[model samples]
Structure formats: structure tokens, C-alpha cells
Target: MAGIEFEIMEHIGKISEGKSGWKKELNLVSWNGNDPKFDIRDWSPDYTKMGKGLTLSAEDLKSLKNVLNEMDI
Candidate 1:
């Protein structure tokens, strides 16, 4: 596979941290210089590496927010 390119447009927040100095975070990212999107994934301490994660568009993010708001807990 070809190398993936990405830019962290915004650092939203950290969800959790692991013992390996990797942290699960939510951020806005642009893949291959395309438009930015909401991303949730794990990144190494220096951000030189990342794990598989989910990417969502603005519409999807709004839907997710609605779902979360409706959840009892």
C-alpha cells in the first residue's frame, strides 16, 4: 500500500492514554490534503505513528451527537 498522508488540522482532546505513551484522541484531520474531518484514533507520543481509527464527516458528527444526547448513559 502507498504511504498515507495526513495533517492534524486541530487537536480536539485526548480520550485516554496508554502505557506505551500512545493516546486515544479526537481531532480534526485532513487526509492527503483533502478537506478536514472529525477523527478518533490513537497516536504515538510524538505523533509519528497512528493506529486505525474512524473518520466522520460533519453530517455524521451531528448524527453521532444526536445519538449520544439521547442515550441514558
Candidate 2:
């Protein structure tokens, strides 16, 4: 059977711009996919590249962001 591809999370924003080809940096994400959970990763560079990253709970993700933002930098 044929299946369709869909996005799991809503692309909220990117922490920074990536270099040319296969080198994306941090990304800000929100879940909107099937059985969604909080995730963090490079988001595959292309159809051939896999982005390195970690997955966290929505609460965890939010707390992490808050802590990072709270830093007096």
C-alpha cells in the first residue's frame, strides 16, 4: 500500500542558520505530528542526511528553554 509523508512537528524557528549543504545547527520545534512528543535534532539535511539530535518531553523542552534564556548572557 502507498503511504503519504507528513511533518510531525510545526517548525517554530531555527536557532541559527546552517552552512551550505548538510550542516544545520540547532532548531526550535513544536510537536504537531502523529502521537507527538517533544523532540530536538538537526532535522535531516537532505533526503540522504540525518540530523543529529535528542528528544525530550514537552515540559522538559520548555524548562530547558527557560533555563537557557534565563542565563544572564
Candidate 3:
């Protein structure tokens, strides 16, 4: 199994990853890391590492954003 290459999922300043080969990752890969989709991710911590991950399509992401924004908290 190879390591996952992560791309920043949001404009959270920098994309700081764990120490090399140390802690697991939870990447929100988008556009194959080309024209990435910097949408907020919603899933478990080790989604990719556990062989299963929740991938939100562009529309889905938009809906999620709307929902998040509507939140009062």
C-alpha cells in the first residue's frame, strides 16, 4: 500500500500534514490534485486509510456548504 498524497481542502492557510510515515491522514482529494475543489470535508478521521472514504460530488459539496452556512451555531 502506498501513501496518500494530500491536497489542501480549504483556504486554511497552509496544508500541514503529519510527520512522514507517522500519523494517518484524512485527505479530501479533488480534481486529482490539479484544479482542486477546496470544499470542506465531512467524514471520519481515517476514511482513506480504512479503505473507504466519503466523497462529495461538486453538487453535494455545495449542498453541504449551504447547510453549514445555515447553521446558527
Which one is best on TM-score?
A: 1
Off by over 4 Å in 2: 1-6, 21-34, 44-48
TM-score of 3: 0.36
Better of 2 and 3 by TM-score: 2
- Scored by lDDT, the top model is 1
Candidate 2 pairs with clashing backbones: 8-33
Return model 2's CA RMSD, one decimal.
5.2
Which digits, one per residue and each the tens of the lDDT, describe model 2 over residues 11-35?
5555544675444444333334445
Compared with the true structure, what per-residue lDDT tens digits does model 1 show for residues 1-73? 1488999999999999999989999999999989999999999999889999999999999999999999998
- The regions of model 3 sitting more than 4 angstroms off are 1-52
Per-residue lDDT for 1-73 in model 3, tens only? 2655555454332223344332323344654456554333333344344333355667787898799999999
Question: Please, what is the TM-score per model?
Answer: 0.93, 0.55, 0.36
**Clash count for each candidate, listed in order shown:** 0, 1, 0
Ranking by TM-score: 1, 2, 3
User: Lowest-scoring 10 consecutive residues by lDDT in candidate 3?
Assistant: 13-22
Residue pairs in candidate 1 whose N, alpha carbon or C atoms collide under 3 angstroms: none
Model 1 residue 25 CA deviation (Å) reads 0.7
Give the higher-lDDT candidate: 2 or 3. 2
RMSD of 3: 7.2
Question: In model 3, how large is the Cα lDDT of residue 25?
Answer: 35
Error of 1 at 1 (Å): 8.6
